[model samples]
Target: MPGIAVRTAAVLLVTVGDGTSFPTAAHLASYAGLAPTTKSSGTSIHGEHAPRGGNRQLKRAMFLSAFAALHDPASHTYYDHCRTRGKTHTQALLRLARQRINVLFAMLRDGTFYEPRTPRLT
Candidate 1:
């Protein structure tokens, strides 16, 4: 929600339509091309990678939103965690986009406003 301003929110709303088409957040992620796909061959297997298919416009919007959201503390923390885990910048951003999809789905499904989560004190 931090990165999603007027234009970005418009793009998402237009792209997602009525939102009932997707039964779950995973469905939305897959439709937006944020879902990873595994490639494998005989006696060989490759790691999961983002698929080339799905709605390119939506995917681009999601990626840009994730990048813009880096300034947010929670998003920054998650991005840093992903980087520390050996994820490249792009990979980390993609993961962030995928993660945000869950929140977006919930908001859309429940017709609720975005509420930032408070940091828990350990």
Candidate 2:
């Protein structure tokens, strides 16, 4: 949630009036167009691709927020982790946005605000 400015938050809130309507984070991600698209045929399945449609405003907001979140240490670590797994910069950012959507869904479900936590050092 780090880099979620007032305007971005407003866009999200407006686009997703009530997050509780989504049963799970995946559902929310799908609705926001953050989930990857899949194509399937009879007995064969194709690889996942970028989603074609959903709430464009929310998707843009999430994308921008994820980009800004790169400045946060925790988010930066996650981005690096994605890159280590062979993801491109854009792919990693999208993945990060999806991850943040999960957290946002949880917050909406629990009616809570963003709470930064310290990562325990091993």
Candidate 3:
């Protein structure tokens, strides 16, 4: 079999907890600094969602999450839905991120773990 790409959950699992142990995506996103950052420069304008301000490894994880959501069939379907709702790639990714955040939240809230049966990066 061809070599499979690495993944965020795998990394998180190794570092923190596996997919079985749920951790909020927001917690992960915040930990990764993928979450928005507020910065106002005297109303002039020079701001980004705060560039790279969290765990380097965890940030990588969110990108992996983004990539996975883009690739996974179910996630792709959701992305298409976002696109149909007039969301751009970035917008779609944000939407996907929001959804991922929910999944993570639910998993953690329920004290359930994520057990991906398929070779999923999603």
The local distance difference test score of model 3 is 0.59
Whose lDDT is greatest here?
1
- Rank ordering of all candidates by lDDT, starting from the highest: 1, 2, 3
Backbone clash total, candidate 3: 3
CA lDDT scores, all candidates in order: 0.92, 0.88, 0.59
Local error of candidate 1 at residue 99 (angstroms): 0.6
lDDT of 2 by residue, 1-122 (tens): 79899999899888887686899999999998999988999989998998989888889899999999989998888888889999999999999899899889989999888887643322
User: Worst lDDT window (10 residues) for model 1?
Assistant: 113-122
Q: What would the TM-score be for candidate 3 when compared with the true structure? A: 0.56
Q: Across residues 15-38, which tens digit of lDDT does each residue of candidate 1 receive?
A: 997689999999999999999888
Regarding TM-score, does 2 or 3 come out ahead?
A: 2
- Candidate 2 global CA lDDT score: 0.88
Model 1 misplacement above 4 A:
40-45, 118-122
lDDT of 3 by residue, 4-116 (tens): 14655566555545433435566666665667767677867656564557767755555557656565666777778878888788767765665665556566566776543
Name the candidate, 1 or 3, with the larger TM-score value: 1
Alpha-carbon RMSD, each predicted model:
2.5, 2.4, 6.5
After aligning candidate 2 to the native by TM-score, how far in Å is the CA of 62 from where it should be?
A: 0.3
